[model samples]
Target: LFQKESHIPLPPKKDYDKVRAAIEDALDKDDYDDGSYGPVLVRLAWHASGSYDKASNTGGSNGATMRFDPERKFGANAGLEVARDLLEPIKKKFDWITYADLWTLAGAVAIEAMGGPTIPWRPGRSDKLENEGCPPDGRLPDGDKGAPHLRDIFYRMGFNDQEIVALSGAHALGRCHADRSGWINPWTNAPTTFSNAYFTELRDNKWTKKKWSGPPQYEDPTGTLMMLPTDMVLIWDKKFKPYVMKYAQDEESFFKDFAAAFSRLLELGVPFDEPGKPAPA
Candidate 1:
């Protein structure tokens, strides 16, 4: 008699650690931008989860829908293919884990591996079958916009101003590739290392609009560092300024707040079971 065998998934923590290691291994590259893909990985995690709308609760990390059409092709998600492709092998290696969990966990792992805070992450996200789960194109923040725009975007996701400021600290990690975002330059000197340097740079730099053919962006005197309108608005806005100053002065506070907010960000719209319910397969 021939009988089919069913597959069993490993314990969440055990497999999560494996996936984390795989992502960490995939991070460093001698030839990649800033010698690591950590930035883009973090961006992937952000875009994956940032689509959540607190009211409708339609789009978020729950489905890992960015893998499909229209959403993957969105301008805001531009260049994220690098991040998705980087994780593809990891997905194959840990086939039992869902894309939603893998993408969010990779973001957390990449942040920690890059010398940032330890963001608490959990499993249970399932992949959406297709693009129907994709969020609308304009959901993500526009780099060219200012303070009000930043609030509208983050507030829609149920994030308060403090959390918005905290999450913005992630700007420390990656550069804007012209081919992708139509903007160029790193936000900090050590783009691969996550730190409060982003805040410090915003506080210290004497920024002037860059004279370039590309979209408007701010630059320091040496022309080495850059800031998008959204990044600059953190300091410009009265409400966001205190948090910015707090993070710039105290790395510990920044790390703590960032970890909490980022962890929350990843968990948005995910419908985890009730406490007593059986764990998700």
Candidate 2:
């Protein structure tokens, strides 16, 4: 008898583009926050992948483990279910794609659709069968902490100070829901657009403690915008401050660095067969 060989064939890049299109179509609705689910989608992708530990290689985007109990219930991940649920119909429509791939792809598409830089993404991640794959609690960053906390959380994921600042630039896109993170307000007036406004606002504005009942957070003089302790520390720290200023001065630089850093962020711990091509717009 002849030996038999069998394997599952991967979807071609064009099929992945169709998935991308479905994600794009699902992004905008008048009823949603800021008229787009883009910000939450980006948050979903970041939180899903941010659990990586370079030393152990245990967490990150590979397993789509956030669907599990402990990880889903993590305080840092509050309100992200909105993002995950938004992607579910797309997941059902394209049943062949893994939840891991779909979540990350929605992030890249959200960024591009919201006037941000193009993030290179690919599809190869697989789902975990059980919650055993969940990373320990506290793997994600704490908004209430400062620079030291930022460094410890990000450094564990193999990122340096520069990359930390670059990744933090993502704050330009979303607002904090009081019910979710115990913080409230957006970092910029144009919260829906992805620009260097985060860095610019952080650089140019004078942030004072918001006189409110909420957790400790900073707000601009007008009390219209806000910043977390983690965000405020980027300007106060010597090492992180320079990049913050750099991105603030040059939109092109911010876009370039953000694209590279954010792209690498979503790919953490994912095993791919080969190099990935540029993601479709």
TM-score of each: 0.93, 0.93
Candidate 1: stretches off by over 4 Å: 1-14, 275-281
- Model 2 agreement with the true structure over 41-100: per-residue lDDT tens digits: 999999999999989987998889999988899999999999999899988888888999
- Cα lDDT tens digits, model 1, 47-147, are 99999999998788989999898899999999999999999999998888899999999999999999998888878788889845578889999999988
Clash tally, candidates in order: 0, 0
The TM-score measured for candidate 1 stands at 0.93
